[model samples]
Target: MDYLIKTGCRKIVHFAAAQHLLIGKNRQNGYLHALYKNGIPVDDNLIFKCDNYNEAAHLTEKLIRSGNTPDAIFAVNDMTALGALSTIKSIGLKVPEDISIIGFTNGLISTMSDPPLSTIEQHGYEMGQIAVRLLLNRLSKDDDGYTPEIRVLKTDLVLRGTTKTLKEDKLGRGLLY
Candidate 1:
């Protein structure tokens, strides 16, 4: 979440499934922290909690109609992001031009969306390789107590057409700013 915000994402609309998982909660907290660190006031109304893809699509349509469009949407996963993309397009809004959408897990659906989605690549294979190496090291160690080391795998951002390089136009920009 911090990384996404650091990349210049402003308002973030999170999409989640029916049963929220611990990971989802953690991500939401991270988003909140990013907003706080950047001095952006968090608006609870901006957070739309949906049950599934269908619900998310409905909520997204409502949001766009109500004029509560966000600069970017961070879906809990790629499936939801794809749904949001469909809804946005169904309403005749140009993706990336009107709003930017991002998803996690870099799932297949992300790439298949109308405008391929941008996602966080969770290198599971790399983590598995590192785990195997660690296990081998542990097994080969002599009969002596050893401190267990932890490795945090870094994530990569896979850019795509779902997001715009520039921030969306701010409301009242011409008159206010």
Candidate 2:
């Protein structure tokens, strides 16, 4: 989210899941931090909380119809992002040009999206492989004292046409509503 803000994104609409999971909470927190850091006052009313993709798409469509289109939408996951994309297009607006959409979890759906969604790559498979390796090491270790290992995977921000280039916005400050 900070990255988005720094890259000239304004008015972030997050599509959170109904269940309050750690991932969802963290993503929301990141949005808040970015808004705060950018000196943009947070607007609680702007946050659209939804249960699933279907609900998110419906709510997003409503917002668009109400003339409350956000500059960028940060979905909790790829599925939700896809839902928003569908709604945005259905409303006769072009992606990135009208509203930039970003999502977490660089799943296949993200890449399959029309413009190819920009997302945060979680690298779940690599993480799982590392976890299995660690477990096997622990299990096969001899009497020699063993120490647990910790591994942190890196996340990359994938660039795609779903977002606009910085030069696209003449005014450095992004659109806010």
Candidate 3:
């Protein structure tokens, strides 16, 4: 995204996981939004739709072999990132050295990787808490005219071994340290 460009990455590949799904579509939109907001031109070629780890890995390999290797990769999820990392390694490349990688959803497996993955943490616990509260509120309200309220939970970026810090000037407020 903007950070990747500011960090001197001219080419960034996005591995989308099932764009038909709500989460997938939203993530893709966010990625495009970041690029547009940063004044980066959209490149359809760099966007690859992948459903799982295997598809991601296969695409990564193909991209490399075709001399279309990206300077950075943004995966839809930790599993996709892991698969891309495996392909990158198989091609004799180093993580955060030759290319940087980032994933969404800071799942447990992310921390256990060889070079721990840098990921965005979705506050699942807080979300569940909010959901329960909403349910209680709904149950407590006997009025049939009650309207649903929408709430947006924030996410945090957990920096780890997969990425390096960009220059201070390139840093944005969106990243939660």
lDDT of 1 at 24: 63
Model 1 regions more than 4 Å off: 1-9, 17-20, 126-152, 166-177
Candidate 2, which ten residues in sequence have the lowest lDDT sum?
Answer: 168-177
As for candidate 1, its clashing pairs are none
Q: Point to the candidate with the largest lDDT.
A: 3
Q: How close is candidate 3 to the true structure, as a TM-score?
A: 0.84
Estimate every model's Cα lDDT from 0 to 1. Answer: 0.75, 0.80, 0.83
Q: What is the lDDT of residue 114 in candidate 2?
A: 94
lDDT of 1 at 82: 78
Q: What is candidate 3's lDDT per residue for 24-122, written digit by digit as tens?
A: 888899889988887778899999897568988999999999999888898999999999988999899988878888888898999998799988898
Model 3: CA > 4 A from native:
135-149, 167-177
Q: Is candidate 2 or 3 superior in lDDT?
A: 3
Q: Model 3 residue 92 lDDT?
A: 95
Q: Give the TM-score of candidate 1.
A: 0.72
- Position 38, candidate 2: lDDT: 84
> 1-177, model 1: which lDDT tens digit per residue?
554564556777877543357666766776677789888889888776763678778888989899988777888777777778889999998877777888778977777887999888878789889999988888888758556887867878788888765333565222211
lDDT measured at residue 157 in model 3 versus the true structure, 0 to 100 = 76
Ranked candidates (TM-score, high to low) = 3, 2, 1
